[model samples]
Target: MYLIAGLQPPMDMRLFLHGFQDFFPSKAWQRTPVLYLPLVAFGRMTPMAWEELDQSLYTLHLPTPVTLRHTGFDVTLKRNRIILEATMEASVIDHLSVKIRNLAQRAGVSATRSLLPSGIPLADITDVDPSVCNLWLATHRHRFASTEEVCEFTVFKTGKNRENTFQEVMSDYQFADLFTPPSELL
Candidate 1:
């Protein structure tokens, strides 16, 4: 978990029309182990521009700050055996996959491993509607012990009108391996 320093530029629709040219790295980017979250109000002004994303994460809040219960890391240690598993929320499946792909390309793991989103269980999965999808990061072996792996998902919004539920939502951002410890992307 990382602290969101501050959003440099207030969210603007201009970000969508242009690629990542406008996104100057927020102060959060410079921090070590940057799992940095963005300010909630920043997410309200714009929606996720999936097409323009590169090596960063976009975020929004629904009045209520999204709470994350660290179920644990992607690595599991059992009998000196390290097992890696990444489980994503149902709504974030697509974006998470993109980050995984980007990290795979940069990390050179694309060819060796098959990054996939499985276990279609709806329990932990909830519709994060009105709560926009923004926030990116890479999940890779370098972040874990030598014996680990990963799986992921995108949390989705439910069918109910969530306008009243969430106050704001983030647009998007790229999750990267570098965000993982030990500076994997480095």
Candidate 2:
């Protein structure tokens, strides 16, 4: 696990991405590994924008290549975006869930025994003007409470909308259900 100095609870424990586009890298784009920095320092950092998270934290290098496939999840690349659909097997989910639980424990937060969806989707377009057909980054907030403390997980998604502007797309919550469990199906 990657650890940074001075990173406090909640704020410190987040999945930071770098050199990624629409949850997957393009053929010409080099893959930058995702870092799990649970106890890093965030005092010297400021959030300029969602796409600029690399500026806030120090990146750690691992011995092996880290990808979503390593965690036993299936990733599909579509025409303009990447999709990550979870499997029903508990082992696969536990692989990622364990990391989250460990982070929460280090932060002193009492997290539930379950793993909530924290899938992130990102998009990068180079050929078009962003103002007209821009890519939008959306975040979903999840609040988990126990008898003592409350833990919040902010999941992110990125998409392109031709019909709506960047501001309008960012303000939309119609796709928020993607991160939530389906009551009818469950």
Candidate 3:
């Protein structure tokens, strides 16, 4: 962070503190593999090189572009009725059913508030599709971008056979201390 901000710590003798836990299964020292490096690698002056031999059981790439089947959306304003819909190869309702009536209300449609549900009720959801996830988020976000400020919703299944979710990234960073690749990966 100091390097990114172009600032140095107050003194060279300063130190940082990380709590110690019994299950912290990472090493204090690890090789700086190109694949193991931090995300700032996006526009690095050089390219990366690697083999699965350096594969990490503990780490993963960030913002991995998970894919979903191609999808489409439906919209209508009939007989003064408003409708919105979408479908996809697979369904995960993380942001599937959002109501834009607030937009209608702002546009002078007062009755829209009572007609639209708090949000759409999703009929189906399966696994998390990274690509689908990205698309759904992008479209819906763009729709509400100007009308709503700071709006987002996320949903996982809430039925039988589900674990309580803290919704956090996994401990992949445990594979090493380095965030970027060694000269090899780069």
**Which candidate leads the pack in TM-score?**
2
* 1 versus 3: better lDDT goes to: 1
Tens digit per residue, CA lDDT, model 2, 1-186: 111221111222222233223344234322322322111211222233322333211122222212222122233343554443221222233343454334434444332243233332223233334333312221211211111111222222222321111211111111112243447966
Mind giving the per-residue lDDT tens digits that candidate 1 earns over 1-186?
111111111123112212221231342221111121122111111123322222233332111112222231232233433222222223343344454345434533323122333311111112222122122212222221121212211222212221122212222332222123344655
Q: Write the per-residue lDDT of candidate 3 for residues 28-71, one digit (tens) a residue.
A: 21111111001110011111111111122112222222112223
Better of 1 and 2 by TM-score: 2
Query: Cα miss at 120, model 2 (Å)?
Result: 7.7
lDDT of 1: 0.24
Q: Which regions of candidate 3 deviate over 4 angstroms?
A: 1-118, 144-186
Report backbone clashes per prediction.
Answer: 43, 5, 16
- lDDT to native, each model: 0.24, 0.26, 0.21
Clashing pairs in 2: 6-41, 7-40, 7-41, 22-122, 121-158
Worst 10 residues of 1 by lDDT: 1-10
Q: What is the descending TM-score order?
A: 2, 1, 3
Predictions: Cα RMSD each: 21.1, 17.8, 24.3
**1 against 2, candidate with superior lDDT:** 2
Candidate numbers, best lDDT first, in rank order: 2, 1, 3
